[model samples]
Target: DTAVSQTPKYLVTQMGNDKSIKCEQNLGHDTMYWYKQDSKKFLKIMFSYNNKELIINETVPNRFSPKSPDKAHLNLHINSLELGDSAVYFCASSLVRGGNNEQFFGPGTRLTVL
Candidate 1:
């Protein structure tokens, strides 16, 4: 079984449409995160939840929100989708909040805004 899993691996939609991506980790990690990888292959942390508490990176837009139903799951909801928001979104989990620990990543959900 996959330690981390995400729903709807591929998504293609209109620019203004809203979208939601769900993530779950079976690793029993205390922290989970959502990351965005742009066309240039640069990865950036969008949001993170530690024990179900949210910790977001300042650069992320307000249109993107992360909800942790539990420590094992973190879902992303995007409102007013934009072309710039198109990217591969990854879900990850770690034993602790920061440093040294290896993070397990999901296969990623590719969002394409037409």
Candidate 2:
């Protein structure tokens, strides 16, 4: 019954490893997105999907990929994880359009690479 949820709230690993974070939403929204917030608190959009179709793809590293099984879920998979990749990954969802539409975020999945 969670609006948005992510697993592995805290992940710590060495460099050059592979990891994944899962996300799900039950808000019945048509669009979902993934955002990365660094230590500086700058939130940047990584990817946005609408009905499993990619709508927005930001300038992100190839090591990161997003997968959407449906309108209510978006997961992130990272390969060759680097220390620079260590950040808080947040899953969000929103309506497709409208001025008042705001993204709802999950608690976040913190990935730490040594």
lDDT scores for all predictions?
A: 0.92, 0.87
In model 2, which runs have C-alpha deviations exceeding 4 angstroms?
97-99
Q: Pairing residues by index, what is the TM-score of model 2?
A: 0.92
lDDT of 2 by residue, 12-106 (tens): 99999989999999988888889999999999999988865785555798888888877778889999998899899999989866535688999
Query: In candidate 2, how many Å is residue 57 off?
Result: 3.7
Judged by TM-score, which candidate is best?
1
- Cα deviation at 9, candidate 1, in Å, is 0.3
| Every model's TM-score | 0.94, 0.92
Evaluated at residue 46, the lDDT of candidate 1 is 90
